[model samples]
Target: MQNALKELILQMADDALVLGHRNSEWTGIGPMLEEDLAFSSMAQDKIGHALALYTILHEHMGEPDPDKLGFMRKEEEYRCCQFVELPIGEYDFTLARHFLYDHAELIRYEMLVNCPFEPLAQMARKVRGELKYHVLHADTFLRELARGTEESKARMQAAIRYAWPYALGMFEITDADAQLAAAGAYAGEKERRSRWLSTVSSIINDAGLQVPEPDEAKAIYGGRKGYHSEYLKPLLDEMTEVVRLDPTAEW
Candidate 1:
């Protein structure tokens, strides 16, 4: 039970760390100044969340320090979903991905709020509050973009189609998932995915967009098992560059 709980926490931490890095890449590159600030703020929130989770692991669960676990791992050691490893392609794709991913994250944390694990449940309560604003930001942008001119709408729709499969990958089930669920440490990916679909569908419908059919959506998996896309290796290399240069040096 403890091992399963640790696995769940590590996956969540990895997801936040990677996606936060991706989002931070937009710091000065967002299409609009407001979006730039918003994404940057969210990026900070995500990385902070990752650090908090890692601290829990280190302080209570006997895991290594957060820096070592986050920066010293080999690419294959990461358990983040393929959805977060991909580069932020464009504003439209980034927006769509953010919208889909955060909704799923929100639901996951909401379930975690009542977890049997006391530390995790406490963390979940805080995380769920932060995610409310994230979903609000994503929803506001999605609605505005979807209702804009033809070009903006087309771009959003295309991004939605392209990201939907990878977004589904965020919910890839693992053997440990059952253990976690049975232990009441988590609600499991299946329930989260179901709620995600319903929530995202409603938002998409309100934005005058069509939700991709689940049967037809091919989820890209394997990240939880240590497999990743071609992009992750390079991203990890970049992420660890400074840390690798001087592992003994204090930040």
Candidate 2:
């Protein structure tokens, strides 16, 4: 039970941390001034979410401190999905990724609101509030851009298609999933993925965008198993550079 819970928490925390950093990259250079602040704000929220999850691991699961767990781990030790690690590409791609990823996150947290695990359930209830706005931001941008000029619609569609497979990978099942679900600690990834599809499909269709068929879209996998793209190592290096420079330094 402990191992299963740890696996689940670690994955969630890593996803938030990596994507938070990616989102932070857009802090000053968003396509527009409003979007610039919006991404920056969301980035802060994600990192805060990561820190909270890491704290749970430290307090309950015998893991290292949140800072060590976040920055001192070897690249392969991190469990974030590859989709989050992908470079924040063009605005369309970033927006598409955000739309797909946050929908899954929102649903996942909603499912966990009543988890048997008290610490996680408490955290989920709080985090979901923030996620509501993240999803709203993504939804609004997606709908408006998809309904905009021909080029905007085309770009949004292409970005969605490109991100589909990787997004599916976010729900890659693991041995720990069955244990967690049976224990009533989580609803499992399959269920969350189902809910996510139903929720996002309607929005995508409403935006005049084609929802990628799950059966036809091959889910990109491996990050959950600690196998990552070349992108992850460099990202890890840059993120941990400060910590490495002076391990004893206090934040």
Candidate 1 Cα errors over 4 Å, as ranges: none
Model 2 residue runs over 4 Å out of place are none
- Per-candidate RMSD vs. true structure? 1.0, 1.0
> For residues 216-237, what per-residue lDDT tens digits would candidate 1 score against the true structure?
2489998998999998999989
Evaluated against the true structure, the overall lDDT of model 1 is: 0.92
lDDT of each: 0.92, 0.94
Q: Lowest-lDDT window of 10 residues in candidate 2?
A: 215-224
* CA lDDT, candidate 2, residue 191: 95
Please state the error at residue 210 of candidate 1 in Å: 0.7
Local error of candidate 2 at 111, Å?
0.8
